[model samples]
Target: MAQRLLLRRFVSVTLRGSSGPVGSRSSARLPRLSSLSWHGTGPPSHHRAGPTAARGFCVSHASGGIFNVQDQADFTDRVINNEKPVLVDFHATWCAPCRVLGPRLEKMVAKQQGKIVMAKVDIDDHTDLALEYKVTVVPTVIAVKDGDIVDRFVGVKSEDDLEVFIKKLI
Candidate 1:
């Protein structure tokens, strides 16, 4: 009876281990979100990967919104040549503050979809662009008009502040 009990305990432990950590079911599989690649040439299309029933990219902004630029070459065309005002967000994946500020920027983009364009450049992925913009910190947001940088915020700023900054351009 003792041997049987020991075997049952071992099986329970093994089953628990095979199932992921607590709270996750063994049969549960995480859905994969689409991978976005921004090469600085322009914002790539939002790609979603998952089960056919899964929702695809759900950017809340208006159409032609949410640009992800990857390289300096792409940045020039997208930001400099664009007719609308541009807000470039220099960020990195590992930055804690950047993560916090990201959603805020998204909301800002949705708020200013027609008046301004939003682009994100990952500093870790594009070091040269970060250096050119003098981005020493993550979550640096720069406002560009007619290819000239008119104003910039080094860290997270309130939406009101961003509004005032953009208002100056108008």
Candidate 2:
């Protein structure tokens, strides 16, 4: 119950644009908190938060195809040496475009059903790998097969364009 109240207060202050600190008891006019339903306790079932609300941050690599490249050695072992063609997604957590394209790439890669895999490399974490690939911008995807770059692209591509790109690799 206490958690729900705190969440409500936080949301109220945030949505209301209160100038005071988040915990401050300001008298700003807060918008309706009806949209937020915690633990299936508030409003109708339709208005309740989804399962993701409780899980917090989770990156599921159970697909066996989508994985993160930890470092240069990990990259060489998993991406460069893998049996399947790997979509080396050069990205960073701070990159706005990378965030947008990451999920799209994951979705398209998932559709392949293990035919191909995605190797996500955070440019900030692995600077050497980024430099080796000559990645100056975020969200650069390289299709690599047998340790050779087959094709590559920079920035976000439309769903249709992504699909076409992935299909061409296979």
Candidate 3:
């Protein structure tokens, strides 16, 4: 029964954004058509933050163009008001798919060569951000251009799809 409810919630959230505990804070903007791929039926099993670079809470593999968002202030300054389009990745350190998606996103952003910037936000550490962005799931990638959300995708996406998403943003 719990699994069924979870599936239902996930479907609703994926299809039409829903209000959660945060009440009026969820985004009204819908996910991009290209961003609608579903990789799983429900949330994956959680894992603990490890000391290794690969499994650490802080992603170290990020290059110059990619960075970890520290706070709402930083997000406002770097993302919302930035000249370049920013890809804000709302993820959790414990989420398995987030781990898989982070590096792939970094690789794709690095290829842009500063044409775009990738901001990594650990949802656990920044619950306020998660709520503000209406991120009910891990690995929610939002494309922001000139202080507005232009597109977004939830869950793990393929490299080709990600590339196309980035290209559309640019």
**Distance (Å) between predicted and true CA of 21, model 2?**
18
Q: Quick one: best lDDT, which candidate?
A: 2
For candidate 1, report its TM-score: 0.61
Given candidate 3, what's the lDDT at residue 138? 82
Model 2 is weakest, by summed lDDT over 10 consecutive residues, at 48-57
Model 2 earns a TM-score of 0.65
Q: What range of 10 consecutive residues in model 1 has the weakest lDDT sum?
A: 30-39
Model 3 steric clash pairs: none
Model 2's number of clashes is 0
lDDT of 1 by residue, 1-170 (tens): 23433543444444334334322355134211112121132323332221221222323334565687846888999888889988888986657788788778777667765777788887756778988888877889888899999988887777787667667754
Tens digits of per-residue lDDT for model 2, 1-170: 23544675576445445444322345233324534423223334223232223311225399889988766888999988988899999986657898899999999999998999999987655778888999988889999998899999999999999999999888
lDDT of model 1 at position 8: 36
RMSD of each: 13.4, 10.4, 13.6
lDDT at residue 36 of model 3 (Cα atoms):
20
Candidate 3 structure, TM-score to reference: 0.65
